[model samples]
Target: MSILKKHPERDPGTAEAVGGEELLVTGGHTFKTLTDKVSGIVEQKPPAQWWLIFVMAVSGMLLLVGVIGWLAWEGTGIWGLNNPVGWGWAIVNFVFWVGIGHAGTLISAILFLLRQQWRTAINRFAEAMTIFAVITALVFPGIHVGRIWLAYYMFPIPNQMLIWPNFRSPLLWDIFAVGTYFTVSTLFWYVGLIPDLATLRDRATNVRKKVLGFFALGWRGGNRQWQHYEKAYLMLAGLATPLVLSVHSVVATDFATSLVPGWHTTIFPPYFVAGAVFSGFGMVMTLALIARKIYGLEDIITVNHLEKMNKIILVTGSMVGYAYMTEFFIAWYSQNEFEVFAFVNRAFGPYAWAYWIMFLCNVITPQIFWFKKLRRSIPVMFVASIFVNIGMWFERFVITVTSLSRDYLPSSWDYFSPSIWDILTFVGSFGLFFTFFLLFLRFLPMVALSEVKGVLPEADPHFYHQKEGDTK
Candidate 1:
């Protein structure tokens, strides 16, 4: 088998599955058929749908480019941002997309560490989401600075004043956090592509495909090469796991470090992480649903996969809900009137609608997962995912707005609304996200062709047993 010949460590670090005598390999070395499966992809392409994705992606790109052009020409005066409501959708969108990026990492890294094989099927596309979402996210903060050219200041550079980025500042932390995440995630995705590229290398018939595929780094199924590759992958995976925690922790510090009552809280770090995974899963669900339908990847994507993700949503949803309750309790128990009023006004005051909507969507809607049937149903899952996305968006909205609205000075209090640009740009962000993702779907393997094959029963099911029954 070429897989074992090319890759080393069949079932990399796989232990014997329960009641089974075989050791399963996960790193593609064990799955010789991986390349064959991946190469078979284009054969399954629906010409009509592929064209549709192309058209939508092009349209989205136009919206993103057009919006940026308009914003650049008109200046920051075009936004709804004001004195107390200084941070508007731009920041909210930044945090929102960044938070959405977390699901990919969790699925790829955390789930892998826990040996959840189901993750393999969706990890590729989800990682793509992480990349594009981060890209869209990066745009907001860079532009939020008003002078787009000065965005370089976020990074420390050699200058006449010898100005260096401040490590103590949360904003500076964001630059490093986001940069590291993007770089590491990209490396992880590409490195995992080697053998698959080789598969393409072997299967490609045209001069262009052969040349491009070969340059994907001449990879023959060499055991030694696989050993080194597996080591690097594991090492990177280990490194990436902590980066996931730290990056979002740093993002939360942006608000928590501030003196504002609603913003100032130690729970922010974990809260943000939970919300990030929550929203990210919602996004993955959104994409996976469409991808499965259009690409006809049902057998690989599976209903069980959706259910597993739903269970995670339920868990994270509860964690986020607990965060809300804990935050309120702490605010009241702290005996601080500013914090007390901030929490009170958010609930029973002018923004009560947002608060209730957030509660109902986040806290109430996820309860549908209690029924196993609903969790696995595609339509139900889609609806629940939409609810989570709305809830998570409102989660950011509530945090940013409630904190900034009624500050210590009552006279400075004001309710903010999004401008036309703000609303369109927000909508256009989805276009940007989908645009990048749709391209990945068409040009690249939407599924981790090699990785998934490695986890298939033929490769060494003994290695990737996510449950005891899989031991067989």
Candidate 2:
């Protein structure tokens, strides 16, 4: 017999039988137990720890709201943008949060298509993370336009102005790409939650049942409901697959379409997509670790799951590093003076410290995953993930700020710095992000309860048939 036998469990989304009874979900649970265990979280009184996290998150959100109101009132003067450096921390944060949103789609859509069973345990939470990250990302662009009221002009409105947005510009492509991605992703997430919501409704108190049932869409576990649910889920997964690639690609075009020395590279689309997955995975790791500890979800979100995500981080990090090298190689090979200056300036210019930090965090830190022992270590993985997040943010900083600060015009070049409002607004987005995340954890089922139940051996009829010695 092989050291690892085929896992007797069956998962609805996974076609292949995985080996090793290493247990994707711990605690021997029947379907009833699984539903109760997950839903009981919402039914129970809030933990002291939960309140502490919620308070901090809400405070940050209040700060974000206050800052946005002030930004609207005071106008763009509160930021550090100037003549040459029109693009500053706002653009950087926008791209940073957008990149951080990619991992959830990758796990929820791409992994599902690939038939990865482990995804069932954490896909719900990951999807929530994606939605919140995108929400944070949308703010920067809205505020960056200076006239917050006029921000709606980016969309095609049948108004008397009759002046449509410049469709030819890649920047405009962002509105379509991100808007579509968010819409589809939200639909996918809500669809997945229906069955679980039904489970919650069945196990809830009278008032709570009404709330859960409203969202549950009258789910009754009938054969027809499961059939339709499966079809809808697969369709959404197929629809979302391309978005994991397209959304960030459109974002990259915003820079690539520009003729700026550092920004004009053709590699931006694929490179940005890779970096997005890298940074998004980093955010997932950061949240997964904290949530697991707080909710005692170590069984559902196992060390193996963490290791798998770490591997993706390492792969995507290497891809980003290669993009960095390719940029330099292209610069040197082309022998273009301005391009060379931009590349060299990025490494050794006034912003060299930021560039080096990006290199260390996005490249060097993730290399720690090459060691299996450290990859599986919670503390090591958590710290490395944090570094990746910081590094990826600085990666955007280096790309956006460094390039614009010292452009082709020698006289107009100037260093970009953030104002107090800029700093506060950026920090406040975190509050908005976590405030939603905490509420999600508190109210919604953090794990996909139905999907997880499907992963158990008892769920597989064939496994029981084999036990009865019935070959057919």
Candidate 3:
């Protein structure tokens, strides 16, 4: 029997199916159970695994800090930059991290706008992921400018000499684009947290209560407060929706506007946007699986939720694969030698290995999701998500390294290799990302309790009448 039919009071939305559709939340949870389950993660002492992972994540973050310091002190020469390949893993890492942040905003903003209630289960941490990924991404560009001290020049601050940033430069565009995206995403995340914070506040004692209360902004859960809260959330969601498209499109512009054969393509914006979403969803899937398992949130973060995410990964992966094929077709059709060479070299040249790895991961791995059995399987989806993340990172590497490594002249051509520092920097970035994520899991309500409650049958006015009628 459907959980809803078994427990007539449970409203699992209006979607109908043979067995009355799958429940988004299982285990016969009432609103109280839901709240207690999510809040308990914060209130209780973390498990040993949490402490182990936290220590490792902190180590990685410290390594990242140390590497950045070394880079600043010694200079960019420590990296493997050569004649033609001015860009290296730094830019690749930058783009990769930025793409990682995309899934969070897409989940929180776009899905919310579409009224995807399932999003409520995962949106909180996904939004947090966006914030941390952006923080990690912002680190690269600042240090990539070579002169760490002169990084201020990237900003549009008026000076005594009347010097200004080049408005036309795409690199300059990243500063404003990512900065605005971070600001809005942070606000949206914090706004969503207020009601949950109030819940924590009411339940806490001593310092915890005071801290939660301060962040809760004196929320009384009154009708007037809820009305204002809804309006603000709607406004923020509307604002962030366009950014879901625009931020990555602007990032793509960094490549599209360049005259480099592979980078200079009209198709880049949409292609990059699609790839970003694909990659972002992959990371979210990976984290969600881990979080769900560790916290024993099988009911809240159900297979139904994962299957939906896998479906998105499949769609976006197809789009990404289409973009890949279209790039080659355009290269061949245009009859441009440099462009053709760029695409050809990506497949057959020295870096062809990276290209194929990307192809396998981005194009082939997600194909498994076509089988409903595989998509819903926990292990299969977990591995596939990891592959997607790997493939997307290689996609950036292939684009950045291949095109730059082989330029217009053979004399300027050189193989771009990452030094030990490069590899460490990249690995350490995960430390930074996960450190923040672990802290978020420990201290905050990882699930949006208020939003989740809103989707319950109990939230529906007619639900009680229906239950009463059935009882009669």
Candidate 4:
């Protein structure tokens, strides 16, 4: 019998029932009549749906192959880059992707330390997003080097040239920042994945499961495994918190340390960090919202979870707003003529339209969260998350182009425009992000099944349902 039927005399939707008592919610509805709705949203699909994801994965791989083929065939000229604007779209894409990468670590590591219980439901996907986004971002810099073969030059070693990369250089800092963050984030994610993978392994009855099982590292969720997992998890959380901040801060240095007018501000560290989390959370919100709807995981991703993330959007978003203000203030205060011009130019520059669009998306749209009703409303949050992501892309653009277009001299100023290839590659990157995510959803349990089911009080089978009759 359903929980509602057991307590037919009690009212529904109360605080103690939802929060304190922590019980599964079963409305006065039967599974027979709701089969279509439940199956459409929840309860794994037939074999056909999985095949669609497999097709998408293959297509995504072809796109990468095509991009590499084109990049190799045309050389660097296919991209939009000139003497002054040499960095162009590739670096912009890199920075944007890295910013998007921060969301996972912030959500999983920082929130975990704060002891936010709601995180247990969503952290797995958020961490996965971080790892994938980093993988995507790392590709750009390597390919941007063009040779694609000698890309290893970015590293320093004991042999060969005996010369080291400039440690003081911002670009070198990027290598450390991105490399360390990716390594740490990957470990954190895989560790958390071990037990769940073991769960899937146990549930599997075929050779495919056997292959995936080997990667499960022989996890059994025994007392020993749990103890080691807990300590390792906590240590990783500690290592990652500072690493997350440092990675993006150093990424900001790629622009901040530069003497260029718009990019030279000291505020880039915090500003970039805020923008990263803002975008990362936006992407997380985008994925999480869809995962809940399409997979019927509402029990795990409650409205409260949505509400809390929206609040985070509001908070980090406000920090980004303050950073924007500080950048303009510092520019004017510095009394540097070029610096002053950069700020003025961005507001009324050729890219001013893009600039304001970013402002509306990043600064204005998230303010809706201040209202209780809007935050809990899924539709509202989904649209807002999309806007935040758009605004973040523009933030990178305003930084890259505004500075590149104009510097110390007017004659050197040039308008940077992306060629057709630039646009295609950008779109293709989205395809790549989504395709991998779709595979992640179809396989490996999108909502972290073992983790989510664990959170329900019924999982205990004791406290929440005492002596059968007492639960009523």
Candidate 5:
């Protein structure tokens, strides 16, 4: 039932045969086999490792909840928000999680629009990661506002007090930007899931069937359904594509609009966008490697898919490095003493340790991918991806902390040190992120079964005719 036969003259070990395109899904898999492999993960009991990870993830999530409750009781006073460095780990984590989400929309929307068939294998989980990361990001802003009860004040809902949220606040902009990004991303992710969910629905019985059947929206895979699905998907993709650029730009605007020396810059939009994609791919690469290895999905996810992601990491990493340099150059060229000091202090001042760590991880680590061997090596990319995220987190730290730690006045300057609450709150956010991701992997098809099938050689009408002609 394999859709593709081995090319007689080609090496069997390679993904590509003589003069053919590289296989997206290897192992000579057919439609049925692919479906069975993906769907079986959800249908069967999760492995022991899954349970262990799930337990850890849930524990982390509980820690987050406990921390939030304590934070609400004690108020923001418990955080390490000093006079100069008012924003601490909370804002750093907010931006980090938001940046972590950009790759999903880029993969799911931008690449799909460009007709990159390779996206089929990874886009589903990438889209899911986007939603989850956004969820995590939203939490920081909510809790950081201090009064969790009055968090609703951020919204423009007509209230008895007639107190309106200042529309000019970047925080308000983030509410709309990230909220829309999350909504469309969830819709895009769900639309992509419909066919695969229906596949699961038909394969399940009793309670599972009813549950999946409800979400599947009666997807029968009929031609009419296919047409409507494709149209809806395309529209959503179009809608989401702009959000990829706009969301991060809005985030950058949070910094750019400020008169703070390090923050005030025109380059932040593109710079932030590049960093977001860089960090986003790093996360996707990390998760994809773990998922494929754990589930024996190598043939489906494929090294080619991973290598492509590495290449992106490299490209965006380079862009991020360039942005770093550009920030310094602008600082120097503008002849502004505050800007110069901000950039200089980031490299050599009190928090220079963090700055160099950011530089090493964000700028230098990904340069390894310039080599083909390293790019394709699983271990290298995995470690590099981890470093990429670490560096990216520090990048935000450097930008946020270094800027505020030393401002216009020398006397008011103070070093920002995060309290234990700051550390626990940030760590707990990861727990929340992983909990959602693990649950998603447990319940949903991580790969888009239908989309992957569409890219297979057999999906072409001429494939059958060509095979027959070759035999003749």
Candidate 6:
């Protein structure tokens, strides 16, 4: 019988039972359903709906290629870099994409440590988003240097000239931080994927089985195999939890260590970290809803799961707002002329429109989640999540452009406007990120099948009596 029909007296919209015991794997999912639903995405042929999205993603990617080609031919001069505004859209884009990448690690690591069961539904999807977003973010700093060919010079190597990158630079710290983040995140994601891959291996035919078997690492599902796997996964989770904080803190250093008025704030580390989580969760919610609809995994990725995610979004969005207010408060409290001017200029200056947009979207928008009805409404949540994403991108732009466009010297001050190439490059990054995401959706198990199964009621060894209806 359907869980819904079985509990006819239960709340119509809820997946829970009469006694209010929450359902984890809903839709009357047996172990077979859990395995089949997840692995089936990979084993089945591509759907017509999936191909439509794939074509669109590829078109965007092609635009990215064309933009990069033009950028390479004409050089950085084609961008909007000028006397005072050197960072322009490149740094803005870099920070925006980096911020979007943070939620995955946070969900996968921190929530796991807290034993949040809801995370199992979304962590795989979020982790994949992180890797793709980081890849898109990496493209900016390399090309922003104007000499893409000399990008290798950022690394420490024994060249004949022996010119090492500036060891003291915060940008150098960014390289270490982001590099380590990507590396550890990949390891963590892959480790989590192994058991799911083993599930795929067991269920597959000849060719598919062989391919998945290789990556499955010869798992026999023995007690020893699980013992080792659990230990390794726990260790990776521990290592990654700290990285979720450290990576963005280092990115903030790229601006905070600078002497620029708005950029030199001491609160940037925590501020950037909060903003990162806020933006990252926004992207996750956006994609999670779409994935839920398209894949018909509504029962597995339930409304309650989404509600929990929105709560996190609300908290982090508020943290970001606190950072914004604190920035203004410190500016006034410090009694520093340039600092005061910077905050004043950000609100009422040339880029005031963007600042207000950021404020409204980041601050005023997410406040809707305060109501339970709005939190459960998918349509409302979808619009709100997109607003948060847009707001975050603007936040980066407002910080990077407004701060640099009007610096200490009035003579060198000029407005920053992105040229055609700059605009296209930024748009192209969305193509790069979504193309990988679409392909991942088509090919991989979107949910962690093994993890989901592990959480099912039957998986408990001590639950044999419950199944037998013995209340001893």
**Residue 407 in model 4: lDDT:** 84
Tally clashing residue pairs in candidate 2.
Answer: 0
lDDT accuracy of residue 124 in candidate 4? 81
lDDT tens string, model 3, 190-302?
99999999999999999999999999999999999899899999999999999878899999999889999999999999999999999999999999999999999998888
In candidate 1, what are the lDDT values of residues 41-80, reduced to their tens digit? 6535645876787677677668877877888887887888
Candidates 5 and 6, the one with greater lDDT: 5
Over the stretch 1-472, how does candidate 4's per-residue lDDT look in tens digits?
6543553322223213333554332332222222333323323553565466557766765677688679977788998888678888788789888888898999889988887767877888898898889888988888898888778888887657787777889888888889999999989988887776776666566885786699788887787878888899899999999999999899888988888889877788888898899999999999888777756667667787888899999999988888888888888889988899998999888889888988899889999999999999988999999999999999888888888888888889889889888877776677677677666665664444445445444345443455245555
lDDT of 1 at 15: 41
* TM-score for each of the candidates: 0.89, 0.95, 0.95, 0.87, 0.95, 0.95
Instruction: Write the number of the candidate with greater lDDT, choosing between 1 and 5.
Output: 5
Reference-based TM-score, model 1: 0.89
**Steric overlap count per candidate:** 7, 0, 1, 0, 0, 0
lDDT of 1 at 8: 38
lDDT of 6: 0.88
Candidate 6 residue runs with Cα over 4 Å from true position: 1-21, 469-472
What does the lDDT read for residue 330 in candidate 3? Answer: 98
lDDT, candidate 6, 173-259, per-residue tens: 889899889899989999989888888888888988899999999888898988988999899999999987999999999999999
- Worst lDDT 10-window in candidate 5: 9-18
Which pairs of residues have clashing backbones in candidate 6? none
TM-score of predicted structure 4: 0.87
> Residue 148 of model 1: what lDDT?
81
